[model samples]
Target: MLREKIFYKDELPVSVITANIVDYPFHFHDDMEIVYVLSGSIILKSGYYTYTLKQGDMFILNDRDMHSLERTDEDNMVMMLQMDLSYFERYYPDLRDQFFVVDMEEDKEENLSVLRNIMAEIMMEILQKGQGYEHKVIESTHNLISCLISDFCYVVNEDGKFQNETGGKTSKILAGRLNRIMDYMYENYERKLTLSEIAENEKLSIYYLSHIIKEATGLSFQDLLSYIRVEESERLLLESGKKIGAIAEEMGFSAVRYYIKHFEQWFGMHPLEYRKRYMGKSMTRESRAKYKRCTPMEIETAIHALTRGAFTETEDKLVLKPVIIDIGTAVGDDDNGQPKTAETSAKDPKEAGIFTIMERSVNDILAEPYHLLMDLGETVLAAGENYVITAEGTDTKDISRLSILVYNYDENVGRSLRKIHTENDLLRLVRHYDDEIEFLIRCNGFSGLYRIYRYRMDRENLAKKLTDSLNPEGGAGKRDMLIGRLTGAPTVTTNTYTSSDVLSVRTTFQGMGVELILVDRI
Candidate 1:
């Protein structure tokens, strides 16, 4: 029997398939799909396109595009990622009017290799189910989509200029209407809005407008209006010192109490407190340490006592400390120009001292450290005067226990410069732009979301900066400006091996993944 794949709105909106089958009946799904031939070969058909996919070949199938596996070898292994179209509709509203046109025979071998590697990684993460696997899957999916969009998908603009464009005029009309409605809501969120008024304005039936609004934004008319108003109020609170009651009235709230209630509900704090927290003071090393529930004295004392020879004179060199533990071995070189072994160094307390008695006491007060291998690049020489900064954590899923270790290597002295703890999982050093380096930090939330943190390296220390002010002229500003959150679900580029301006990241909210692109805004 021919089957139809059903997608539930509350689900993850993605499905992974890795199986070998022969002579499957034709079926259709509302979700778009990408099929990659992992090994062996398969013959498949989608709409009018028929092709034989060998190892490393792949193709895309749009929503409701009927396709079937005509043949497969006994050892054939294929992977397919299917995602609901509604998922993209929220971000890329024109997705419905587009169709992917990929010709493996015409594509460059390098492009094929890139796509193959991305799909393979996605399959590995999905099958392995490792920590942050959900995040990995979401990121890979966005990468795949981005690749298709950049290379293959032919999007139909309002003027209609692409071949194989689906939906044509109907898609354009619907998109235009939705965009208009959203624009109107955003422009007039401070005023009272009703479905009937919006419907009459857009010349849409109230019933159809209501349904489409929910389908397009996942929010009803009132809810979306409230969301916009609250967002505007937040901006006003941070940017101005107006009285709360006056601000509420200006934002179209009937009463100050009502605005206060909604503001608290949205931000988990009152407007005055929110304003004070963001607009009041700059976050110094001591204040950040306090925010993480640790003391600057404690971190400084432990590092100073344990490092033996390395020194830190000012708090400007220290960034954050979310975890601290003794690794039991000193991380420097000896006078003989050789790396000192933990066992050998134990013979001489000073030479072998990576941790002193006081440091151990502090470690006991803090937390036990975990041994993690630093993942330097493959091309990095083992023997060189290199200063490497890497991070380690006890658990991959928990960023709160992650520690950043600085290893200073020279012919005579090869030891750890310092170790600082952080509150998030450190993924990778994306790139260095201007005077700052951007790091992808995994948020310790269920949504599997990631945040981009900008840091400035000073000698042997790293100082965190607000993402907005990547190139601050002087002193640090408010704490909230230090990090910038990206929009959309996290995604990577097809050519992962090549350095590009756009970096892919995945962040989840309440078990769902949203892909985001980290760009050098500075």
Candidate 2:
């Protein structure tokens, strides 16, 4: 039986908008709208805000928000539905459901495409003029809503706090107040909103307001204000393309020096330095490490870190780039007289079959040649192979490190190798090497030969070697694992091998227990 999906507002009229890419106007709506992108991309303009939409993308706009759309020279199909506020209130019969919202962004290409296809089906029904087009559209919308809500539930339930936090009356009231305060901050952060002014806005004494905020968010009001300023500064730095001095002044910093100091205190780096390093990218380890876990400060730190230096406060320009890289297999041979290769290749399945049959021959020739490298403790990172050394965070430069490429190995083959190595006490050696080495596992490839790489830590020496080694014919099976650490999961072929195959390889670590994580094929 299909379950009825719960949407927040029951009494709201559902206003469906189907438009060709060219007709979309930059207009705001008085009704809550859920946009499901179809065919091509669409632009959504709400009030002074605009968001880009692509195939299968969903955007929810609040009521009375001014929004519009623009057509880009890309794929262009879109569907929009507006929910009447009265309908929502009648259907939900609960005010608590009105304020909560969910947003999801997926990086998994396959999953994203699947969602796009699902949304396309709904759009197709509307386009085809079907008998039950309205019902179908509504049903599809509910399905998408359910999927989104499921994701929201999964994420919030990870900490198991949503029920207690949102279910209690006091918590609900506090949450509403907090939301208002946040809105106020967002609206007036640029202007100085003093503690007394904020307290007056909240109709509470300064002390009580401070205590409540600390209890709720575990941050002092001053620190919270500073956090807001820092966050906005970071956004401006990445988006504005403005000068550091100007950005500091705009963010209400007393002076450039003061901004620099506070910015460094907030992110462990000066604003200019941060902009220089990551004006439009991800954060460094140092910045991520500065904050404690499980707090708004941590969330803010992670946000900045995840965005890296992409949004800079120095420049008031927004530059967001789509990051993509091809995950490929690398194969190489060491000085030993043996050759290393995987038994499959997704690119050429015909070759994969031949390699599969030759596995026994290859195994015989190589004879379990996986050597483990011992971890050299806290070796100051010197240099890495085939990498450009650039400033990372504030003080450190990036190093290209050796990486072990894990291709899809049949579960049986991996287990067999593990078993043979385990009986010979060689698994211990592999673990030791894993601690210092980094492994990149790819499940799409079949051949093991494409997964090998060799490198040293010294950049000057490593670059020469890497250049020589990465050349298609020359670098076969030469790269060692860099800064070896055992990767958590081993990529295994599904429907081909299972954990039963892995259980065949049992071994102990100095009479201690060890757990192995066998991953499902990606």
Per-model TM-score, in order, reads: 0.36, 0.27
- Runs of candidate 1 with Cα error greater than 4 angstroms are 1-3, 6-11, 72-75, 156-502, 508-522
Per-prediction RMSD in angstroms? 24.6, 26.5
- lDDT on C-alpha atoms for all candidate structures: 0.44, 0.38
Residues 85-127, model 1: lDDT tens digits? 7764543467766666556765555545545555555555545
Q: Which ten residues in a row have the lowest lDDT in candidate 1?
A: 311-320
Candidate 2 global lDDT: 0.38
Give the clash count for each candidate.
Answer: 23, 85
Output the TM-score of candidate 2.
0.27
Worst 10 residues of 2 by lDDT: 499-508
